[model samples]
Target: MRVAHLSLGDFRNYRTAELELRAGANLILGPNGQGKTNLVEAIAYFATLRSHRTSSDTPLIRAGAGAAIARMKLEAAGRDVLLELQINREGANRAQVNRNTVRAREVTRWFSAVAFVPEDLTIVRGEPSGRRRFLDDALVSRHPIAAGVLGDYERVVRQRNSLLKSGRGSARTVEATLGIWDDQLVEFGSQIMLARRELVRDLGDPLSAGYRALVDGDHGPALHLSESVVDTLKERGVSRETRAEGSQSNVELADVSRETLAQEFRDALSAVRLKEIDRGVTLLGPHRDDLLLTLNDLPVKGYASHGESWSFALSMKMALATLLREESPAGDPVIILDDVFAELDSGRRGRLMSAVSEFEQVIVTAAVEADVPREWDWNRVQIRAGEILPAGEQTSGTPEPKSPADTDPAPGESLSTKDSEQ
Candidate 1:
């Protein structure tokens, strides 16, 4: 999938902006606070309906505007899709695809992209929440339908937590009502756990290969899908049924079925029912899980050096992009490198560039033109104070900004110069 053109209105610092992109590589150049990251961020948000930089939608909209609108001309599987999104501050966001209104979540099916940003280092060095988010994003990228599954699971958890909180005083009533929420939790949560375990299993080889290629070290990178239900039982010394539960005698996670997971989840809830009511929360589910990343048999967070952590984070994203290329109906995902090259050393920068150069389209943003690798044929666009000016243009701050672009440039006119020596 590729974005042929993008236009933003009342989004972040951009009152109005538009740009036409190419298939190979598009380089967006600007100094700090000029909306370079904001431009790429808007493009990525169209894929995930969320931001990587911040957690709130209020910051996404212009200060005085009631809403923000983003529209894209996407090319996917040889057809053009017109995707429009309206993000309102006081109401639910809305989306339209091919001029037909649809749920905002439904827009994910139209395009896909994998972003490599400096913040991705959190996957290796941060808390379980970050790793879980990494897992969920990869799950959605692999199967768009998984997004709905994730939404259902989150809703069930939230509703179940509300029931647990409000009905705490009456033990009998709480138990009875909790049984219903337990069934739904086990159903949705078990499916999520199964998918996550399978994803970690499949990522093993690719992550190892990518790490080996990126870092000239003997450390072996491995991913372990740590489940709360199993770990809780293990901590309590509760032995699981071996061969009777549709698993091998040892009950390896890879061999467990959804039914096996559901049964275990149910048992776990039964064991911890009273404790959960006391705490006003739901436990023993995929939401409590973590993706354990290790290097040389050690956890990467507290043990690995800074360089090692960066390499691991980069390898994981690269491996994910590679795996999805094999699974995606679209031949290649739109790769966005947002101010990432500046953070990497020269050797690592060259290696990273070589790793992703083969993709059908790559978008890179840099504060200086020289920071980006100069070997490729780059379709360059210069952003000056939230305006998409032609390449090599510069300006000081203007008193009154122009309205967002009414239309993008003609197809071929957006490129300042196309590198000819492929």
Candidate 2:
């Protein structure tokens, strides 16, 4: 699906802004600190419901503002859907679809986008938590309902951990109470684990193909889940060592039934019960799992070269986008590259563009016009100090920041602008 229009109020640096986008390539060109990333972040908010830049929603609302308003007009399969979100600084966020109120999580079901940002390198080079976030985010994008499952699983983990911490010195007293949490943990955690395994299994082929397309070498890119439940069943604390030793590939998780996984999860909890009370933490669950990204039999985190790591991360995203395109009824997920071309070499930049060029829509943000591929006739828009300028506006020299009155849409005026002439 393509974002036909995006409107923002008090989001990031934008006080009030409206951007009109078109199908195929659209480029947002601006210098540093000019809200290029913020623009795309707002569009993606509907898809993932979280910012790629920050872990908290407070930073998304402009300073001194109580809430940030983001409204998107999307088109797919001859349908138009309007998704709106009010990100609050203090209270629960609000959402709407086609002007009808919905549970905030419901907004994700209408839009699907795959964003490639500079931080993606962290997926390969960073800590296990980053990789876990990658898996959970992909799960949400694939099936919006997975968002609820993830939320429930996270709640279960938190409550279970609380019980574990409270029972630190009184194991016998809290044992019965802990059993209730354990059952809840297994119930929700097993669903997450099973969904994750299915996602990893389906991503295998597309990931391999994408890696080959980007690097032109089959470094044999692969995904392996170092599941806490599976590892605990094999041997205590095996999942903890998966990263350091790079032997996570040995864990087999594909085609495991939920009943089997639930039993294993229970066994894992039983295996770690007393130790968990002593440690005051839930020792085994999806929360502790790691998605081991491998290239040519070695873990990407410790062994892959810088270039190889970047390609693997990018390929992982492309693989998800491909999977979504194949399964989604709404059409291909919008491909977003947020200042990503600037990070790649000339060869990879062209290759990356070509790799995603066939999607229904691609929106790119770049500080320099030359960083983007020039042959596709990009629909270009300019941004300056949070203001979105009209189509084809030149930004070669530093431009004075426009006042809010200059760009804000007039009351009842249409936000739609003619598709910028290529």
Best by lDDT: 2
* Candidate 1 C-alpha lDDT tens digits along 170-245: 5675787778878888888888888887778778777887887777655899888777898776666667774233
Tens digits of per-residue lDDT for model 2 on 302-421?
898888988999999999999999999999999999999888888888889999999999999999988888878788898775568865664564344332233433322323322111
Pick out the ten consecutive residues of candidate 1 with the lowest summed lDDT: 413-422
Task: Mark the 10 consecutive residues where model 2 has the least summed lDDT.
Answer: 413-422
Name the TM-score of candidate 2.
Answer: 0.90
Give per-model TM-scores: 0.89, 0.90
lDDT for predicted candidate 2 compared with the true structure: 0.83
